[model samples]
Target: MDFVKKLPRTSSGHDTIWVIVDRLTKSAYFMPMREDYKMDMLAILYLNEIVARHGVPISIISDRDSRFTSRFLAVNARGPELVQETTEKISQIKDGLKAARDRQKSDADKRRKPLEFSVVIFSAALHGWYYMVFVTTVGEEYDKVFNHFGYVKCTT
Candidate 1:
């Protein structure tokens, strides 16, 4: 996302073009606004016009533009809730989390397996059973089968 500033004013009082693009898909939104618009206005506009429609992005890359500086965000966009951090401190935290985060994702991918039966797992917990076996048929021929598992046969 970037801004194209100092253009001829439109009849609608819009002179700046807010160029926001999705890097993965190459889709774009060329929003029109005034060059003197405040950061608070811009942030709200971004949330409504961009995030509301597309969803929150994982990250955003910018060109270190003056308008996007942390000072502007800290003062205007995020007041008391957000604590300003030094660049070095931010990088240190990022480096610390990177390895653990990657390992967790890798472990999750390797060990993941789909459930065979959804209802049986839930039902087992509800009934306090260690195991459940569905018996569909019963006869004299199946007597040995029932006896091995210790399941009582029902006539009805």
Candidate 2:
């Protein structure tokens, strides 16, 4: 659906790459190209590479570069009936996407619950997130407490 141009020229003279993607299936194609190719040549390339395999697309989303816009019009003008079918297909895809989004939201709603809890302060002193008591008042602090819990000794 877009070109990555101005690449280091290959031995075959390709300096651009056309990156095409199918949104629904998430499949992609990277076709090498010459940067100087005209609109008509690009159109022919598209017909051969894309249309030959996947048929006409439901719609194309592009950045509206002049080359792409011209080619888009040329491709779209193939027939009125085809255009109408493409339009309907586009609408159907949009509706399907909306339905998928709604389903996901419904699933998430089923899992949603309010947080309910309480904090119990067992220690008289709150040192950072952990609660502990510093031992300025302890009679045998090292033997009675801290030493048994090694690293916890520093915390107190």
Across 1-156, the per-residue lDDT of candidate 2 in tens digits comes to: 899988999999999999989877789999999999999999999899989998875666566754787777787777978879999999999999999999999999999774434322232233444444443433434445444543333333
- Write down the RMSD of all candidates, one decimal each: 18.9, 14.0
Misplaced by over 4 Å in model 1 are: 57-156
Clash counts per candidate, in order, are: 0, 2
Candidate 1, poorest ten consecutive residues by summed lDDT: 116-125
For candidate 1, the TM-score is 0.36
Model 1, CA-based lDDT: 0.70
TM-score of each: 0.36, 0.36
Give a tens-digit lDDT track for model 1, residues 1-156. Answer: 899989999999999999998867789999999998899999999989988987975555567755566566667565333445455678889988998899999999899764443112112224443444434432224445545655544433
* Local lDDT at 2 for model 2: 94
List clashing residue pairs in candidate 2: 1-19, 1-20
Predicted structure 2: lDDT: 0.75
